[model samples]
Target: MWENKIRCPCSRCSNNKFLCEDKVTEHILNRGFTGAYTIWSLHGEHDVGQSLRSRDRVEPYASNKEHEEYGEPIYDEEIENPYSRMVKDAMGPEVAFNYGCENESRLQRLYMSCKTAEYMTWHVQNQSDDGVLKHPIDGEEILSRLNSLPDLPFGTKCGDQKISGYGVSHNWVKNSILWDLPYWHMLFIRHNLDVMHIEHNVFENIFNTMMDVKGMTKDNLKARQDLKVSCKRPELELMKNNGKIFKLKAAYTLNKEEIKKICAWVKQMRFPDGFASNISRCINEIDYKFYRMKSHDCHIFLQRLLLIVFHDMVPHSIWDAITGISHFFRDLCTTEILVDHMEALQGKICETICKLEKIFPSGFFDSMEHLPIHLPYEAKFGGPIQYRWMYPFERFLQHLKKKVKNRASVEGSICEAYIIEEISSFSSWYFEPAMRTRLNRMPRNDDGGDVDSQGRLSIFIHFGRAFGPLEKSRFLDEDEFYAAELYVLMNSEEMLPYIKMFDEIIKGDVVHISEDELEKVRDARFVKWFKNYVATRMDEIDPRILEISHGPGRMIMSRPDTPLEPVTTVVVS
Candidate 1:
């Protein structure tokens, strides 16, 4: 009876635990299927592929009017004028925006639950006494302002239905739904910024300006025009050349040859596996501009590679400022943050931006540059920037986009695909421990197959899967073959005892030898002496010892493969 039993796929069990056949049927009857398990792979039913005709077929039933009347907006058609509709919808009253419950119900959930009630008053206990800012909750000025401000009356509107002559109340247009909570304003870390996008924007501004890409650069014609009026820099002011207005080359912007050189360097670069994407493809040699760089690519550039590529190429002042900003971001995005250090970082970042302000034009300092000032404060309370970033959500959205098989009915297709994925995920929990699931899949570079666990030499173990095609097989020279054998034996765990024995014999032979000289003697003659020593122990020895004594073979397979290092190549224009 135990041999025939299987895990139940009911809502309660969710394929996580096993149950007897009778109990499983009873559970299913009582609780229904877990994530609607239609594919019964565990019950000897394979997932047969549906015909193309059936898969592509769009089954239509209800109209938009009928959906509205029935109090269901299950299926929404693709918005034709999405931007305009979005703006119009955003401007409408908030009375229709309520989804789960009324304001009273949400407040009750926050205050009534013993677990939640403790969290509501956590700030009062956790707030710091020292002047140093560790978390947002420790912020004195912000908290004082929040506490001082009078709460807006419930249902108060700004411009929609103005009670007084003023369009807004204390610069606030409308009362936020969150303000309904008594403790909303008092809570620390009320708003958090997405550092992923912030990094991308900051990198975009700096890269474009330094490279002086046409139209995209912050050091454009209009910027120079503004520079003339705003600042007293005579060199940067626009001059009328041959009846056409022309801007002089700024000291910060790179020349044509410098841009070409940078682009060429980025093109020929390679990266380690899984480190970053093919950034070389994004480089356009003809135009000398980077294109189609994703957020992660921007992240890689800002955090790691930005300074390396631009170290000595740009002017000294510009490079110094850029390095300061780069180091600031690299430190900010660290997984483990020290609270005591955030106060210093906050001041350092402000100084770094000021240095940038001195070098670059006025237009260079956009909201992205200014946003970093608040980030350290947020990071103080928010912890690591990874939790607040949009990288995971962006990847998940990309995954959802791949699920669009039927583009005509995209919503329907995503829904169906999502349901199927849920079913598979629920069923995967019951799979055997040894079986490969999504979470337990092998990494790209795992090439070591199963080996004898008992008495094998560690030197025979291979790691990092071979990449590219094998070009040819050839025999190594006498010296090359010996070198390989020595390397393997030196690194092998099984050969450690023999190596130590040889070392002791060496120490005895050269009584007055120094440490460095003794190491050289061991490296030079250890292999030959070890081989002869192993041969003497032929009567009772492991097979591995005999094999090592014979040494490695001359023949080896050659392949032209290099690590995809995190780098880019450049083509000279």
Candidate 2:
């Protein structure tokens, strides 16, 4: 069995405790049930006997030619690894994705399952132990010891592929579909290590560091010193002119007063409606206020709630690092984002994490160390991080469990629920969707009529960030609609003829508008908005690559007359 990473047991396996598709279906089909739900009739299953039966006449059917016919050996060394050729020939190169398994025993067992090995493999006169790379491989030539043989009796049916296993038992070939191995391995990469686990652990470490829990509060003298120096203000007006730079104890971690102040600040700040009432639920459930937050308060505290509570009590670097990591993950989870952009964001994020090390107690880095290594790999896999994440699956599992109305046979209840749900969904595809999906209800007199399903558009007509939203989009202006049509045409590289066609269509218009004039107006408006946004929120801009005006009138103003973090005029010529 594979190593399960998440806390979930059922997410990795099923009610029958089966993780591997091959094993579970085979076991079920062997029961000889001829029902519609039997393994032979399972449409979702690729490896069922019925599915494989049709593929026997295919051109790429499993080749059984001897190793001598190909003139290429599976193993490099002739004397050792003799069974490697026989194993490859039996397994077939089509299934070469998991030709190398993470567990050497499984790979060995696979080899041992083959009946073609004529030479001595494992346990050859006690020269060495069975072949395994227990330690990290670095500068070693002596990997060839031997593969362990299977404990199964010699003449069992599937002990050899030649007997029947190919088309009679499985479709999709004997290829390793485990973890997208073919895609990653050929590119010199292994399967993606689940990033959700790494992120949760890292966030947990950050939360623990802030909470200043036991065992972690030990004197990390260098970390303390580094944090103190980084956090130290250049001067304090309250401290007299005689005041000198000095280290503060518990500089990296918050003290009691600071926690109280943070709580006071959070309480004072206005929040969304019912937020105050909702927070009361936390205290009522946990028996403690946010001021007295506990160390064991899970990943959500670090991921979401921390931003609301954190204030000036902590150093800006520590705050930025925490927020930066949170932002990085949130960005990765977005479906519309490009992979190249994410990889770029990952680099900037790594820099923030490196800065975070300065604030941690010297050896406290080991607490969340694997995070940086894992960050780069997540970008390699296509689509959003949520597709690879366990959170959504874990949440949906609760929904699935809720579908089980009967305690006696939960699986059967779930199947019944799923079939009902599937039938409803399929019916919705052909019928009136608004009635079946959005609900059959009378619209309010005040509500807009015949609204588009994809929500309200901006003032600029058809322009919108996403294809769909909470409210229906409307075409508010004719010019804006044409402008949007032009925009799409330009993006598709067919704008020239469209512009000519538009010019031809608007023959009898009372007011004449040229294509070039419309483009010029749109471009100017876009540039204006871009400049204004940059001017107001330069600090919030990612990577902060904008050049500050350190030229004339850029005096470093101090005190009441001139507010700190001076807002200067940006000259964009």
Candidate 3:
């Protein structure tokens, strides 16, 4: 008998005996070789010959020349054979193709058999009432049964087996109660099939049944209301307690007086339990003696004492009372002592100046003209004679000018004349004494070196005259005239001592001269006198300027002595 056959060379194909090589080839050639034929021929049967024929036949129909030139053959082994090469030369290489034929074939058979069997069985089973069925219990009947059940024990397994037993009993009870109802038969079947399961069905049935009994719509609304009521009570209570605690702690930490007042307020308030009474008792026990002191000084002393005592401990409530009390006493005592010392120092200053005025009247007053007028002395001017006590004789002029502005006017021309006479007379007195002091203080060869002491007396005596009252002018006009005369006289060796004094004071820090002061010094006519003195002394002592004037290639030599020419060529070369 010639039977209809379909073949797949795959080893796992269900019907091995049904495969036909002839049919497979005819299918490839007629239907055009699909990927299935290529895959089955090569990988399933290892049938290289069939693949080559398909490859050769399909190549001539290639879409382009490049594909024909290097296209893969249906059976790759054919590339080496003469006949295959000739066939390819005459036509073209076939397209090699692969597809999942084995999987498709197996699935097609399975689907056809399963679908046929399902249809037959479905029809046969549906004809009988008990064969295949659906539950007939409506949502209302299931809800009624659930509501009737007593609440399950908390630890009950609620597994499917237990649920199945309950479901059967529940269905019987439902029918007995609703025997005359039209849907009783339907309800019985539904309770058996829909509600019972072998595992984990009890919890699901209970939940679903409860949902139906309550009605999902009402249950959701009730849940929302319950949550709101639960949340509000705790929130309001929390806020009320927090506000009371916040007020109590804030008053306690910041101001002791405020804390006492607040505690009294709490005691008057109608608080729950003994809360107000307890808080008031706690406040009374705390040490608040320091609270009577002023805040600023108390705070400073408290902070300092705390730093000394508890620098290593992290600060907490335990040390606050002790530190505050200590600070109050410390600030009050220290401030009183400071006030007493200041008063005593003021008294001493007033007595000293009176004695100084009597000892050397002219010498002391003349020294006062150049003293610094600081702010404290400025405020005390004329109000009291106390400044004269603190200031030395040299500072008397500053105190007079600042304190008694009329002192200069009071002394008048006679004072100026007297000052001029006194400055000149005092120069001799001050110069010899200063020179002797310098000489006596000088380092000797036995102590260190003779270099520092050799001309020490002469140098210092010269310096003393240049810096002493002689250098300070009594009036503006006199100062200008004296500076001009001094400049000219300074061009000679006789005036060298004054120049040395000017140099010493200019470089020294005793005067604390700023750049502005130096500029003022430079603008003063006395600077010209000092410069001329320096040049004149250098000329007399060294005689090097005369030598430089006659030196070879000297540019200055080109100028005339009387009417000197401006030497335009600065360098001789």
Q: On a 0 to 100 scale, what is the lDDT of residue 444 in model 2?
A: 28
Sequence-dependent TM-score of model 3: 0.11
Candidate 1 residues 141-166, lDDT tens each?
35665566654232212212213333
TM-score of each: 0.55, 0.39, 0.11
Which runs in model 1 stand beyond 4 Å of their true positions?
1-176, 447-462, 472-558, 562-573
Could you arrange the candidates by lDDT from highest to lowest?
Answer: 1, 2, 3
Per-residue lDDT of model 3, residues 1-573, tens digit only: 126555534334422445465755555456554444433433234455867978968776763555567784544353365544535765666777786565324423322333333433442244323211122111234435555656533221112112224434435333346666545654422322110111112122212221222342122333333434544422212123745521112111224454344445533433222211222232332542222222222233333433243323323432343343333223322311232333443444334334323221122222221121121122121112222223244345654454333554655644665576567654434344345543245533122322434333221222110111212113224444444444444454544565567646675943777778764564464545555555666656434323322222311112211111111111121
lDDT of 3: 0.35
Between 2 and 3, whose lDDT is larger? 2
| Clash totals in order | 18, 5, 6
Error of model 2, residue 150, in angstroms: 38
Task: Determine which window of 10 residues in candidate 3 has minimal summed lDDT.
Answer: 560-569
Tell me the whole-model lDDT of each prediction, alpha carbons only: 0.74, 0.45, 0.35
User: Considering summed lDDT, which 10 consecutive residues are worst modelled in model 2?
Assistant: 138-147
